[model samples]
Target: MDTEKVTDRKVELEKEDGHALHKRLSQVDPEMAAKLHPHDKRKVARSLQVFEETGISHSEFLHRQHSEEGGGPLGGPLKFPNLCILWLHADQTGPGPSVPPVYGLEVSDVSKWEESVLEPALEIVQSFIQGHKPVAAPVKMPCNEMENKRSYHMCDLCDRIIIGDREWAAHIKSKSHLHQLKKRRRLDSDAVTAIENQSISPDCDKELKEKGSPEQNEKELKSSV
Candidate 1:
């Protein structure tokens, strides 16, 4: 691919709104977008948003996510070493005998990666190590689920805890869920979608149908007249 063209695309993506960015990514790199889990979509979007606003390179973004300085909602640094190892494995024929286990991965090796895989990748994700330092940490999802409460289903996209099976069922067809699903390039005629739809309560579907019915609209119109 044209390196400059790729770089420009990355730059454009960085500047785009999160939802729009996701849509563009889905169109251009659907495989990569599809690999993103639902729970991670917002986090990735948040990271992309942070990168766009701060002009940080993706590596720097990952570094911040891996470090304690990025704050609590980001989980921990260990979450990234595995990703690094995955990168390494993808680069080599295999791990090569010298490649260490995931837990043994080190930041010192990041320099090596930077020279090889990272530098090339940077063309697609320009970094801002020297300028426009971030003013604040990126926001993360609040996964607050208290013990012993009404049953809830945490949205894999936004992480909002929705209570009740019926409510959760209705939520799957909601705009928020659809937005997130599209963001992850997951809005497909797949078994997963089937399962989510199948989980909806019959009553909720009826209510939704009634709410959208022309008869209800006509009734309201007649009453108002």
Candidate 2:
């Protein structure tokens, strides 16, 4: 629980509470998509711990937009190149990168949409998984017959949230947000190994370095070899 080893330059947390709270808020924590405005120092420290482990601003990363399509703010796709690539596990699936595909489902008026629709869907899925009973095909979308199937815009990066136009444009310009984009661009940079920041903490940095954008590495390998 000792944070004396962490650097202060990486973050400068606001300390306005008592000594206990000051000690707690000393570290940079996850904003959970920047949703909860916490006052407790310990909570801030724990949040920072989660952020460091994931390299994600936990609280800040939550509920990106009022739009429910992807619950939090969206940061489109990978914008960088890959440097070090260990393609030893080339599967028959075309020797390609193992980036998982995302499906951004935009349901119109999702917030007001009845849980009746979702609950039954999950029940059927669970029933199938548990081998409970022989059920027919499955439930249908109650609003399927509605005329205007609302169309939605999806954010590319993180692929989690669907966002409104105004928020989308602003997100593209945020410092932390844009820097993430730059990192994607260098995923395949042939100039250096990704280990330059190897000493960076093991939490969030690990995943960021390992899977920042392995796709870039695959493209580079295919072209060079």
Candidate 3:
């Protein structure tokens, strides 16, 4: 085949490969597959390409997709107020004379909406589509049941060795540990107060004195003389 023909053939094969990957992805995670730019063949191919590079089976890849380690699906059932519409100016007039106008779009507002608002909305939409209400708490895989060999660190307050660096860090910053620390401080403060209340009199003599019988004292004085 001519170089040009060979190049065209390669491109055709790549497109076929991407479409096949998309078909599988649609069955496993339709929503995730939908997020790709359908018009951009290269972008569509990239997702499956990365998975292939991992050298794992397709089933294992799908398992990881929904795992916490994978960051799970981008959707859930948590609803959030529409920020862009909510923050839209009710009146599009220039800032009032009494109220100085803040010029330009609030980049922070846009960022907050993107980072926080969108996820919950997606989750809520997902739940509705899935024909279920959002779960209050996701069922977690126990540390003991996990396949990875993780290092553990001791949490003094919890008195347990939490498996994995992330778990240990979370435990130390957890409300349970914080509450225990607060209780410990209160107990220590009360003990100090009790000691203060029961302290020895301030006027009590601190000077040292020798104890001796009368004869011993007299003999010492005569010897000194």
Top model number, lDDT: 3
Model 2 scores a TM of 0.18
Q: Between candidates 1 and 2, name the one with more favorable lDDT.
A: 1
lDDT of each: 0.49, 0.43, 0.50
Better of 2 and 3 by TM-score: 3
What's the residue-level lDDT of 70 in candidate 1? 30
Flag regions of model 1 displaced more than 4 Å.
Answer: 1-9, 37-225
Please list all clashing residue pairs in model 3, or write none if there are none: 76-123, 76-124, 77-123, 77-124
Instruction: Put down candidate 1 lDDT per residue, 5-85, tens digits, no spaces.
Output: 334434544454655665644554444344343334454465455555676644455455656653343344343321222
Task: Give me the displacement of residue 36 in model 2, in angstroms.
Answer: 19
Q: Rank the candidates by lDDT, best first.
A: 3, 1, 2
TM-score of the candidate numbered 1?
0.20
Question: Where does model 2 exceed 4 Å of error?
Answer: 1-151, 191-225
* Predicted candidate 2 versus true structure: per-residue lDDT over 29-139, tens digit per residue: 422313222443444555565566676655444434324442322332334422122121122222222232211222455684345335544554465557564242322
Of the two candidates 1 and 3, the one with more favorable lDDT, higher being better, is: 3
